[model samples]
Target: MATMCLLNICLVLLFSTEIYSLDCKMLHLQQNKVNMKSLELLSKMGGQFPLQCLNENRNVGFLQKVLRPTESQKENAKLIILEIFQQIFNIFSKNLTQAAWDRSFIQSFQNGLYQQIEQLEKCLHSERENEIPYLGNEKILFPLLKLKKYFERIGDFLKEKQYSLCAWETIRWEMERCLLFVDQLTERLQN
Candidate 1:
């Protein structure tokens, strides 16, 4: 009897995850407009990054390799996207206010990004705080590791530039690319 009850619980979880997944996919589809607005606001905030920073550098293309098309396990991709957003959110939290960049704009940008993060978190399950999610699966772990380095390199760049306006500007460009990929991944989530 207990085994049958356990099976029923598992089935319910499976169905709920699917329903949540559908909602998450739709959420991303709807988010494109909102994300474009945020990006436009960011551009208004700063775009005068230094010339050297604009030199088609190595780090700019790291994301393409890391966030490839969704494979058999769309959930893994979702988790990676979640991790990516969390990392960017942290970067913004730590450095955005340092330069006194337009107070209202900053608040609005953070709020929009925070809302998206919350929506994604609502639909996904993982013990993603300290440890990596899906640890044993090399396929899943690979992208997570690559993205970790990508965000870390962004940190390194910011530190090298003393987190100046130009540095934040470059980071803004990078963040835009990350969100675009997030959109792609969310669209590719299984129906």
Candidate 2:
């Protein structure tokens, strides 16, 4: 039942990346930890998700509409970016408890996600004496609210399946897409 409200900012400055040019690719280059390019690793060691996992909880194009590059998206880029990460954290964390998996698999993803989230958060806080403001403009707000519902649906779906291996498999599939989307967004992100 964990939710991803803004966590406390890690006061350390060196952990930050530029908000305008978040280099997720750089995250993968770390020699000793889980690579952020998880899709590459997963694909290399390929296995198909169960057939039951194939029927996805459709997002009604809300995710596309939000992430689609537009003037409005540009204006509210920071909030959109944060929202994406928040959703990722929420799903990934929920899966940690709801889905039983090998310890190494779950822990690695959790650690990688936390590191990425904290880096973004630290960057957002770099200019401010306090936390980043929780903005509420409709441009991002509506889509974010929509995305939130989609994520909640995912959580509900997980419970509905009694946290089956297939249920977790479906979630893992979704999360792979989510993380890949984040990586793509990181490439194009601008101030």
Most accurate candidate by TM-score: 1
Question: What TM-score goes with each of the models?
Answer: 0.69, 0.64
Off by over 4 Å in 2: 1-35, 40-47, 51-62, 65-67, 95-100, 127-134
lDDT tens digits, residue span 142-189, model 2? 767766876777778777777677676766666667656555455444
lDDT digits (tens) for residues 1-191 of candidate 1: 64564355345434543544555546555456446656765665564555755653435455766556744256575677678778877888876644546655555566656655666777564335555557788887878888888888888878877787667777887787777777677665544
Local accuracy by lDDT, each model: 0.65, 0.52
Question: What's the distance in Å from true for residue 58, model 2?
Answer: 6.7
Pairs with backbone N, CA or C atoms under 3 Å apart (clashes), candidate 1:
none
Question: After aligning candidate 2 to the native by TM-score, how far in Å is the CA of 135 from where it should be?
Answer: 1.7
CA lDDT, candidate 1, residue 29: 52
Off by over 4 Å in 1: 1-25, 47-61, 70-73, 97-100, 126-133
> What does the lDDT read for residue 82 in candidate 2?
65
